[model samples]
Target: MSSAPSSTVFLASPDADTPAAAQALATIRERVLAATARGTPLDIQGGNTKRWYGQTPAGEPLDMRMYRGIVSYDPAELVITARAGTPLAEIEATLAERGQILPFEPPHFGPGATLGGCIAAGLAGPRRPHVGAPRDFVLGAVIMNGQGQVLHFGGQVMKNVAGYDVSRVLAGALGTLGVLLELSIKVLPCPVAEATLRFALPQAQAIEQLNRWGGQPLPLMGSAWHDGVLHVRLGGAAAAVAAARATLGGEPVDAMEAHAFWQSLREQSHPFFANAPLMGDGQPLWRLSVPPTTPPLAHSDEHLIEWGGAQRWWITPRAAADVRAIAAAAGGHATLFRHGDKLAGVFTPPPAALRAIGERLQHAFDPSRIFNRQRLYR
Candidate 1:
């Protein structure tokens, strides 16, 4: 069990006083216990920005927004612990003040995004390939299970693992296992310099070039290909970024403009996203994860390649079976990312063995099935 220094700073909302928070936690616990006893379901909610994600939501609303605040932050130790409902904006602002950042670069889908929702959603931004994902940064977590028991897993430090690390499992769980109460995550120092460069090339050429650069010792942070343009972002020490820029040989974009470009891509606010409809049919968006070496898919006109070609965003009306088969042929899987018919299954079906293991874990953690039923899988 690791603890923060006593001189920790707490950034909390006005209504989230100590007594009120304690009472709120108690109420949540009681509600969970009652639901478990009655065999009812609980739909955990924070910020609700990502309510559209995952399968159709279920269970009674268990609001966690009142339990908001930063429990601890040690810049020297590169760790921050916060309550589940803490605002993502506040957390980022606090980290910015110390020239530190969450290396995973989790996206805030909307203004009211919360820390817990970000961790639960587990959606990383452009730097995900270069740095890591939300699960990689998770050091520890405190959660309330379906039985209303508070359980702690992992520790505040990265090396404290002694067995199965349950903390990381909570990432992308969609709150099916339990309700996350607090989380301690690792952070990294902000890069001293950053730049984005652009190259105009065909899809095949862009994929080849991106994969080639991936093997080299460069400050490559993010890469995306859209509209016949490949955008590469380099971040590190000033010298390294400049050296990589020279080696990459792409026209440099202005710093401010580049930042905005990346942000638009990250938040899906770019014109490409706005015009993602396939052949103007207003079809759903699909996400395909495949080997970077895989060639472009057939009839994928409205698409953007990201994560050095590992992630492909497709705006197509192709049937789920057809899209999934293509992704499988490419040696990966596909996800109906947004604006899709979720009832048809938003995620690819897991292998039988993997699904069995998930079921066992779910039963172990939530015997009564009181938490976010069928949100992750049917």
Candidate 2:
């Protein structure tokens, strides 16, 4: 839960200081209307944890903190519908009672994160490659577009095809597109057992090993690198996992320990985050996505590589030019994910055609571009 430190900080989702009521939706719509009439950018925000991921918006910031709750859930249908501002943890907890889980394995991202924020940012955790990305499971959304008019896409029904799939498109639009009100998505049953294995291998060696093993038969959920260590998690029937582990040659760590390990890894809570005399001061974190075949970073720095080597979470204190240079050399691009906004191009700049389409959509939805205009696209 988030506590409102001041008017400038309207904390949303599991707010420790504030529990948004059902009226938060009306309040949000009202504020949005006011902003549209005034033509001032609204500071669209959800989770502060991922705030450092991209460019800081320039606006009077809009926080969706007041709108939070699960609207409905059906265990038989394996679908859970909730308000946009519902905390992901709450949704997952509710689903757990029915033995269903978010197939995407979306990161809870602490208390302040909201379902709307997660979808808007298209944020995913280490399990993404195996389960699916955030947007993949997003079924529908009720949003208040730039004009403060409510809109719908998809629906609660899984077989729905009533309209354009702008629902998924809105997933990573970063609120520059529209303000999400409520969303419905599919959920899955949690695996019976889970385990994570960590190996102290050099980056190049680990890359080679994973590439080779990737060709073999095994249940590999996802892999990531933090500092100089490689961590891999496996989930499924307990028998298969045990067989896979025995053949993989990594020491086995049970579910409880693996959970703690992943939590620490995801939040940068391990020795990787510690101050070491040998490493000097650590640098900012950059999230890079590229082809898995891209060579290991030649730069002298630590990286947390995930998604079967397709994602590079590089940590270094390099200038924007240098970061972009590395990304180009590796046939990919970079965005500042943590500790550095100076080097990021927020919201992963889209292709020219997409940008034009985005602008057109932005104009059509928000004629004044008054909703978080300065936060994402700009």
Candidate 3:
């Protein structure tokens, strides 16, 4: 193991490395283990889109940006493996060529989002509830734990999560558990064709429509957050989509329109981003994931509850106490997705057991607390 500096200013720079699979793995493992020994934390960053998330920390960021690229793509198996630092756009393009997709509905801000960041955040677009979360398709990973020891979890062969399920456990873990060097994810083949249906319905009616479609085999690629319109995307065989379209009365929007709509929803652009100019000094953006059947818009007055009914994006200038209360009432987890403050907590209340488990895992991987110390769990 190599010993590097205790800490370095961790923004716009990262612990660098090459894109080669072996080289990337070696560098990440070395940096994380060293971080643990030095008792220095790391600031894990991607395209830096969600940099404002939670409380920002001061430490050496084990920047994964340097280790990037697709490692392997097996079209027959529908599994794609890539370095953690590989850009999401690159992943999508690779999958598109093979006629396969992530199916978890990953959103890319630009040419910057890395595969590692997506897994750590567990971000899924409107199609999440229907298919699954980022973890559902997660097959395996090669990670550098906090202890500076490299560990591989899950398996390349399908249906092979034999013993401990560390791969699934790390989803949405915010790099608190370990540093993902490379990941092997089960993918889905792309459909032959796809289309979306836009219906103008009130909030209640939209909810009902979504539930109805959920019961049926409508290939819902994405839905929701259209100013006042309820947009439901259907993807699959052209025959299937056409049949579904015949039953409904909707003017088919072109592929361009549909793609643009989904991309916006993927990144939470509409409604919230619309007020960018009006936002002064930057208030925080809170994301709440609620059940579809919540009290009919109890907090509707304060925030914009979109995505059928599950995901919500609340932009408030109020205090954190008020936001947490609303999320608790709505039945979901509250996360400071984007904020101006560098010291405010990103997540609401993490369960005691979960926190304890996280701490133990952190220690196991990084005994020295080398990576992002107290940034997530503190």
Top lDDT prediction, candidate number: 1
Error of 3 at 72 (Å): 1.6
How do the residues 1-378 of candidate 3 rate in per-residue lDDT, one tens digit apiece?
Answer: 122223321212123333354575677677766766676777877776555444665577667887787666766666777778888888888767656778888776555788998888787886777778888888898777665566778876667885327888778777777778778888876766778777777677777776676677766666774445777777787888888788665778888988887777777565555543222455667777778766455555335545567776767766777777877887777777765443556777678997788778766766676555666645
Candidate 2's residue-wise lDDT over 1-378, tens digit each? 122122211113322223345467668888888988887888777765456545666687677756767766766666677777778778777777666678766655467778888887787776787778777787788788766678888876679855437877887777777788778787777777677887888887888777777787667777876667887888787897888888887766677888887776555565655531112334566778877767688887766678878888776777767887778788888776656445345445768997798778878788888766656644
Candidate 2 segments exceeding 4 Å error: 1-22, 273-282, 341-344
- Could you tell me every candidate's TM-score relative to the true structure? 0.94, 0.86, 0.86
Q: What are the lDDT scores of the predictions, listed in order?
A: 0.86, 0.71, 0.70
| Collision pairs in model 1 | none
Better of 2 and 3 by lDDT: 2
Model 1 per-residue lDDT tens digits across residues 265-309: 888887877754322334688889999888888774589999999
A best-first ranking of the candidates according to their lDDT comes to 1, 2, 3
Question: lDDT of model 3 at residue 175?
Answer: 75
RMSD of candidates 1 onward, in order: 4.0, 7.3, 8.1
Q: How many backbone clashes does candidate 1 have?
A: 0
Candidate 1 has a TM-score of: 0.94
